[model samples]
Target chain A: MESKNDELLEISNLETLDNYLSNMDNSKSNSYISKIPEVCKEYPCCLGIDEAGRGPVLGPMVYGISFCPVNEGSLLVELNCEDSKVLNEKKRDDIFVDICKHSNKIGWAVEVISPNKICNSMLGRSKYSLNQVSMDSAIGLIKAAINGGVKIEHIFVDTVGPADKYQAYLKNLFPKYKITVENKADSKYPIVSAASICAKVVRDHALQTWKCKEGHEYTFKEFGSGYPADPVTKKFLADNVDVVFGFPQLVRFSWSTASNILKDEAYHVEWEDIENEAPSPISNSTITSFFKMTNQKSEKPLNTFFSDRYLSRKVDL
Target chain B: MAIHIQSGKNDIQTNPKFSNNIHSMPFKIHADCDAQISKYFLQTPIEKEILSASFRGHPLLGKEIQIPAGYRGVVLHETMKPATEKEDRKFYVIHTFDKFKYWNWEKAPSKNDPLVQAMDWIDIAEALHSPVVEE
Candidate 1:
């Protein structure tokens, strides 16, 4: 049966999320977050900025820098510096040496947002809202750089929100430094690319800490293992979640798993080992009317087949 | 040298020396250690060479940075050439420094190459965009 939450979502028009992933160039994200007077491309200081963990249902967000001088470009580039996604373990292995070997400057900031914190949020404030908070941490890193008196030429970034909102968020924090927020700053700028690697590597390690809880630890590849949709991820959740002992502290119980249990009257009856109380004062006729209304919904082709509507749910699985 | 070097302020260059004292620089992480950088004044190079991965003028300039702890990705220095000429890949490096303090790349160490070692430090100097190393 459709829950009230499902009804609210249907009316919200928030379903088809369109990020800046496909249309990249117009993305104005650079390392800096303010307006910069256009200067010669030959200028020495350049900032690259980008972010990770946007749509995942779990895990903290991250952003960082792998920047050097224009002249060091050959050496840094010799590190085969590019977006983090393009390289694999073997490739990142070779490129990382060249990147750091030629390094003149490198700095990063990591905010480890706990899954418990996400689970504790009041209804309607999904992990997306918390990820937005993590983006604020990136602004902290940038502000730290500028406060250290790092003069930057141009800032490149992979944007996450309405460009204007993100810009405003940084304005009070960084009175100086031009800001450009866009998607895929990873592919467009080398510093952002390097930052992606640092951020990715950091978050990937964090995910590993919680990989094995109660025996039967599944070794997950270094990636988005936090989301419930991952096969191994779902299995991890299935094995670790013990409602009898209260939900696993790391799992987001406000999600469908918990919601489904709450709605299943039969589960409550069997789980509590309770017999049904006397019929409600509303009478059998009224209860029948409620069932009639619900039955009508089940008759609809879209809602009837459990498998047909399964993919429509936002859960990664 | 003039290639990749820049003029940073003087106050930012005071190097903190070990007192021959037991407790020295805190193992604690500093965002960018200005004191460590101050010890080694990075005077700009007079002539430019092919870019390595370093930039002298970058605002967060620091020399105290620990080099790559190990190698994950590997590539030739010449590969930094724009991808239009050949296939591009992720940048990585092999560590020459055994005592890197912070950044962790030590996961996978590789055998060394005679050619890379034989290259003149002058070329390596130019590639990283710095002048001659005091050491």
Candidate 2:
């Protein structure tokens, strides 16, 4: 009953975001993708894995894998599982179950890299760590599959991060399998399209779940699809970020978002307070402390969605 | 002679992962390896060429590639929605970015980020061409 009420509120309250975007115009650039031939030699059982939302402002990076026997993958091909971007969400949602049904195997591994941790990396070479998380999850998924005894001769992944990084990651991770990580592997391969569907659906659910549990009270607010240049999302940040301790547990402080939130100020002041520079990982107790903070502040008791053991690390010395 | 080392058009699959254990550089698999498989795998070479070239010369390549914005463009059959020429064909074969790069009518993204290190890549393999259907 509560879930039903929350969904209704989200739909009704965020009604201003009614503008429809053509999925085609919004598709990943072609330069990021390519095609591969059906290596029938790797048949009997072949697996393809990919990820989505690695660059988004909100939500966990979701990794998905789709598998089918090369001999009996007629169901997958018949569904026209070309690419997830080519199909509407309704169509994707509808066929998702069917694809997994025909899949020789399917799996989703999601890791929510928090905004604070992301904040540290943002100061470094890149702003997003979802790519790193994606690489990790992809490696974990393949390792899981190999352990599960499914024979995958060829592995396809939509490319992520620097091309060089992808190459290094794959070589070091799966030296035995012919893992091809190109952009638009979805457009070029049905297997990847299937992987995209699994990733997309799962991540969308993760976002909606976070939204439902948090409600409209505070700790986090509207990110307006979590894309940069979203006016409403930007406004939400300006409206809420004045508190001294800083942004919500979910807000990625490493994004231009944190700096932009402090745009009114010179930014150096904000940095001094939030600069969490330490070679050591934040103990899980810090995560718990954050949860307690939110729960204490909110009108309702907050549920901890992630780990709690992030404290007791002797204060980052 | 080295068994007259059979080359080109070999229908076979040898592990590229462990090439040192198998064939040497420019190695030959059974006549039906990637060469033959690649050709048939591609439904239309013209379309694949267009996509390959566009990807190689990406429009979003900020300062890395200096392409002029006014350059002409073309599209591939798959990238476009309709098989016929009437639909929205946004696939531009050649285009420039920030009024700089001329997209040399040829080259692939792989070439720009050349594989000099020869490390493993995240290679996603899709069947390049759809299976031929009789009209």
Task: Name the 10 consecutive residues with the lowest summed lDDT in model 1 chain A.
Answer: A11-20
lDDT, residue B121, model 1: 35
TM-scores for the candidates: 0.42, 0.45
DockQ for the candidates, in order: 0.01, 0.01
lDDT of 2 by residue, A226-316 (tens): 5556676676667655333234434555566655665453222211223336666755665557645353444442232111212122222
Error of 1 at A44 (Å): 5.5
| Model 1, span A53-155: residue lDDT tens | 5444444444565444444445445556778788875565445444433333443333344444344332221223544555665766666555545566556
In terms of lDDT, model 2 sits at: 0.45
Q: Give the Cα error of residue A7 in candidate 1, in Å.
A: 55
> Taking chain A by itself, what TM-score does each prediction score?
0.56, 0.61
Q: Report clashes for each candidate as comma-separated counts.
A: 59, 46
